[model samples]
Target chain A: MTDLVKESSTQILAREMALTEQSVERRRRIVGLEPDDLARIAGIREVVLAQVDHFASVFFDYLSGIEEGRVLTNNRALTERARELKRSHLIAMVGGDYGRAYAEQRLELAVLYGRVGLELRVFIAAFHRLLRSIGEAVMKSTPQAPLEAFASFMALKKIAFFDIGVIVDAVVFERERVIRQQQDAIRELSTPVLQVRARLLLLPIIGVIDTHRARLITDSLLKAIRANRAKVVVMDVTGVATIDSKVANHLMQTVTAAKLMGASVIVTGLSAEVAQSLVALGIDLTTLNTIGDLQGGMDEAERALGYRVVSMDPRRDGAPLSPG
Target chain B: MPVPVLKQGSVLIASIQAALSDRDLVELRDDLADRVGRHRSRGVVIDVTALDVLDSFATRTIRSIAYTAKLRGAETVVVGIQPEVAFAMVQLGLSLDGIETALDLEEGMALLQAREAERVG
Candidate 1:
């Protein structure tokens, strides 16, 4: 009867070991966890498989948060919340007799989480929570010196996350600032010049001369020439291409507006296609300067000013316009 | 499936190696959009040199392609616009305003190379 009882107990132990092995294998496949290796690292008896399973589940939540892009905003409030959670988990884990083994598993998980695309903000938050939890657990269960050092190491890990988060936030802010500055510059360039020189102002058309930009160009040219008290203004079209009827009409309107302002206007860079298009549309450009190109228009300006283009070192002396 | 034409280059050079019908055009648009987004090429040169005529739809598609490229932080240049087709485009009152066009494949290559050089230097 005593032998029979011994045989039954041995059979029960064998069945339990098989079940534990199966559970570990299943967790490895599902969560990408290597439990046997982690159990060894934790230095807890391999027989205690339940604790490893529990820790793996907790680490998986931290991983999910990182992938979602939410925890990455690097806000101070969010980091504090994450710290609180890690402290609670560590406290619970350290209270158990298997403290060393569990702490090792947590440390390994923390490193892996860092290597993942987890944003520094979220990682810091998770690390702080982890440190707090481990500290509480260690103090409750073990009075050992090594456990205290382990707790200090975890706290150090939290500081590293904080430093990384600051760097990431700074980089993100600077990039946004530069982008805003560029946008502002473009806006300033696009703003129409209300006035030029005392008698005439030049409105050089740049970029794709769409119907909208063409209208803005015409309106601004008219306003500037009038406001500046100029006798003549040049409408340079060197940058313009593929002028349609709408654009040609806008040009005519500029001529009429400048005349109203008591200033004459010059239309330059009449590409062959644009000239043909104007002709096809039956629009007349006979009253305008209608120069062949920008250089010719500049020469006309120089002639009107009684000045000629001469090479001069701008730094030594301002760009000099010699009398024509 | 639209057969992807492979060109010899250190980086993968895949071209739309088939006649573009309406469906083909839509697929090409999506494929190029994906490529531009994923690879972030310096510039994507769409060689329409084989195509002599560009209908309104084709022009519209090219404009869309250019816009998608811009969103992906890459420039799009349409190459091989025959003079006759350009004339027709002007007559049709279609706008190619926001797009850059090259006279031939060589010009396209030169323009892209110059742009890349400017970026590096």
Candidate 2:
């Protein structure tokens, strides 16, 4: 009964066109529906309206009876709600008004459906059920008007095909966006400069130093130094597995820039491989203080500031000494 | 103008105040070498805290002064090298070859005395 009322041409056209125009101005300019396509689809409003409930009930009943949908005991209320949602979505689709809001809504649905772990095979099968049910519904309604009914049914299929293609694209786009966000977060975590002591910073490089990572290191380390008002920066590169001339040059520049900010730079953890590489490139690391490890660098920085640590009772701390 | 090389006891303090051109640095280098000889200085301290820039030419001049002072039996220490200047040298790969450095004037004076004692002992 509701489906028959929803099939009223004037009411359906008025609501769908209003929605389409409200957001048509600022929409993702995708493939569009021609006026002819809209007119052809609109001609079937009466047929779709008369059979909407039957088609929806057939699609939902089959979905709920299937093994995938019956995975859990879907309570009665939940099944009814899900059926209603599917019916409304089908009604909107047959309305034949697609725009950005339509695309965006599909994007949200894609994310939701992905989270539910809906298998593509199951979804494809469900869509086949939709086609058969709607086709059967329209055919039964217009048996005498065979030619008109076939054209209207084909128009419905065409519109549904376009929506499915958009859905697939939106799902892929959303998945890629998630991956890019994860990469960005990992990149941020990978490069970190810690202020280990007041006026002292420790940067421990833990992986390969590609050009992109190198640039990130420079910008972040420089910003950290200035922000901390640090007097010393001890860069520990023990974990850097392989380095080339380019990485070496970037490290050199970072050290230099840190110094320019009035902070003394001490580089630590120079592996034998890196040392040899530096020598081969004719790059000089002698001017900047290069220590064996983080501890040595820390000790050197503390001593430069005229402070030293000694175990109490067992050993004496820095004793006051006479200056020459 | 030529940079002045002032004498403080047995240590000669050459405070580089003005922006040094290539020519000025060369003249200062000669003048420093001459003054150390005349004063019979035991140590030379080149204070470069006021310098805004330290190009290759300036760094080379300072290194040469340190070498010349060494030959004249005076231990040389380049002191008060601002971090910015040091950074520039490192980027340029100057290395300030063979020049001893101290953090400040007091450290420079202390280093000079220590070297003197090492020699005497």
Candidate 3:
């Protein structure tokens, strides 16, 4: 079933999910940054690196003290458990190359933060606390020129905010990617097209026919029809829970597209609910060929294929000597 | 340029080999109808695989041409619509609804033959 139209299913999946996988190069291009500013931020790497542990301790101490942060951490010892990870994130913001490479790493961090139940307010407050710690640490560590340290801290601030923006976008993109992948899997499972006979295909739709799955069903069925030169396609909807006017329209379009390719469609498993909805919506699916169940649809397909089943001796189970 | 329509036995085969101007499509429509009448063709297969874009004008022409051929007793089957074009067409609601279609020329001819057999038998 899968091997028949392998390439097309993947092609459609990629196209539908393409909008979710945001490109780091594209993001970098949009948010242009000068090398000097990056260098200044990079300079904080060593300074932060020395006091990173202290910075993490201070930040998490402040976070775990807050009511929202306590709820986020579930009252766990966040300072003891997550300090190392937080320290590394701070170091990455200060030292790591703010390019495509770090953007990917930032995505991982985003996913982790999202899973850990970090809310936006808490997240912003945590960043603010880190900035305060950096100011205090810089004042204590720097000598001679406080103004130069201030400039470096300002650069660090810009980089921090920029990294935060990237991380937020990455979180949204990752969530979307995961959702699209799940949709792909569900679509694949629900709209399984089987080669029932020599030139006959069967698609049993067993769930909600959202527009995504509907498009996938159409693409897959058409591809199978073209590849196998199928004479008939049976779309069984016994498993479909329910559908709206839009989904009904999708079915019409699917039938039309398959017919356009010279394949006769037999949509089976039309429960009373779907029929009622079609009637209520006034969606004219009269042009589409349909049957009651899988067996009936297959029988009709066999008839269309000019196959006549008759009881015969097991010795030759159905081979005629000649066409005549 | 006017699209060429060729007679292949009882079936007529024509492929839109280039992007047709409005005049060309109109000419093709009239020419196909005339040939369907003259040859007493049983089937007409219009292939659009080579066409990059199938605009509303072209879609309407094809639909009207199919109707005209059907009026002259020739069943029309459009063939070789690219997958993307089919998807876009369905979305645009220019479904060309009720017209017979095939994946390629071979299937188109087979469908025509099957219908012819059904009609006779």
Candidate 4:
């Protein structure tokens, strides 16, 4: 039984070493890492390293040549190198103490490559795979160590990538969406609405309104007012924390646009700071219905729609209307 | 005297902490041009929040900074001109044509950082 155990362990070691060599070779070819350079760094047998390096270079060249005259282009080569580093690290992690040292060394190398602005996505993917393999190997060897560290590292990397990717994609998507929406709104302005409707168009604006967004809002409101043929349009600014001259000018533009479409514009939701800003800017909203809040704006909107506010009378068990 | 500058990442930022006088404006333009010439920086953001009054001279100086900085291979951003100041400048028919304006110092810094990232990435 002891002899059998020794044989199994030896087999595992040999397999892991072979896998590592294969990965290193594959990666070297992709990244243009010379075989001699890798051999010098790894300090392994020259003949073995040379064989691995030659195979890697030939394989990559063949792969590239077969597909589009070069399977591994510059971009693909970087990705492949990152992948190989990760695989080699994973294989090394299976050898207990020796594997741990190998894994650490590989991580250091990956970090160094990161400084050169290499493919971060590829590196991250490789890091994830390495962590997973390490966790699995540790669980099989010393289950008591708890895979918490490895798990957390992998999770954090995943989340960081996901968060950054989402933020970047969101910013790009939102900018494009706003541009498209603005174009649509501007196009709508050119085409007049056939008839008037009873609904009021409410545009609640918040945050610092930049010139670009301000222009878009003005175009959109004007288009909506014309399209809806609404009698009242409420421009709620309650959520707007502050206003500058540009924002105030944009509001004034909206009011003017609404008036041109034969619609009364109601400006509401002014914070103290914004109100002060507007007053300081000396922007005139004399022609526009300036409400303090959404409720007031809503009431005004309802009134414009010919709905009168009636007080509930207990005696009548229903409601009573004041004399008009 | 050496210009007071803050380095955030690869971006070099200068804060113009006082109202712009003719002398101050001249000094600022020279200082900024000199800094850009020396650093070969990714970008430069000038925070002008403390400048209450932006006369035509100041406005011209700001535009010149943008032009000169661009010539020196650095993007220049002018930030934190108050609403009242903006209104005053507009009323005076001042042009902020070439210079980029941010709402505050933080936003200005963020803009410069983004510009640097765009350049490097």
Best candidate, TM-score: 3
How does model 1 score on DockQ? 0.02
How much is the lDDT of residue A262 in candidate 1? 37
Q: List the per-model TM-score of the A chain.
A: 0.35, 0.53, 0.51, 0.37
On DockQ, the leading prediction is 3
**Residue-level lDDT tens digits of model 1 in A1-324:** 954764454344334233244443442344333334333224322212334344333443564456553432244454343344344444433233222233222332232233333555565565455445434443444457666545443433333333333234333443455687875554345734423334445667654554556556655664454345455576777666667766665566655544433355677788888788878888777766788876676667656645545658666355445333
List per-prediction Cα lDDT, in the order shown: 0.52, 0.70, 0.75, 0.55
TM of chain B vs. native, candidate 4 = 0.88
The TM-score-based order of candidates, best leading, equals 3, 2, 1, 4
Q: Which 10 successive residues of model 3 chain A have the least lDDT summed?
A: A12-21
Model 4 chain A, poorest ten-residue lDDT window? A39-48
Score every model by TM-score: 0.31, 0.51, 0.55, 0.30
Interface RMSD of each: 15.8, 5.6, 1.4, 12.8
Per-residue lDDT of candidate 3, residues B1-121 (tens digit): 6677888999999878888899999998988999998999989999998985788898999999999998899999999987667777777777677788878888788889989999999
lDDT per residue for candidate 4 within A178-264, as digits (tens), equals: 677875664343212223236577777755566666666666665565456455777787766677766776676656545433456
lDDT of 3 by residue, A1-324 (tens): 743454444334334434223554455445555567777767666778888878777767776788877744563643343565676677777764765545544454454566676776687788788889887777666777788788778777766766677666655665677787876676667566899788888888876677888889899888888788787888887887776778778888888777766788898888888788878988777777877777887777888888876547576567542222
Off by over 4 Å in 1: A1-324, B1-19
Where is model 3 more than 4 Å wrong at Cα? A1-190, A280-284, A311-324, B118-121
Highest lDDT scorer: 3
In order, the TM-score of chain B in each prediction is 0.83, 0.93, 0.96, 0.88
lDDT of 1 by residue, B24-55 (tens): 77777888777765665657777765565677
RMSD list, candidates in order: 24.8, 10.1, 12.1, 24.4
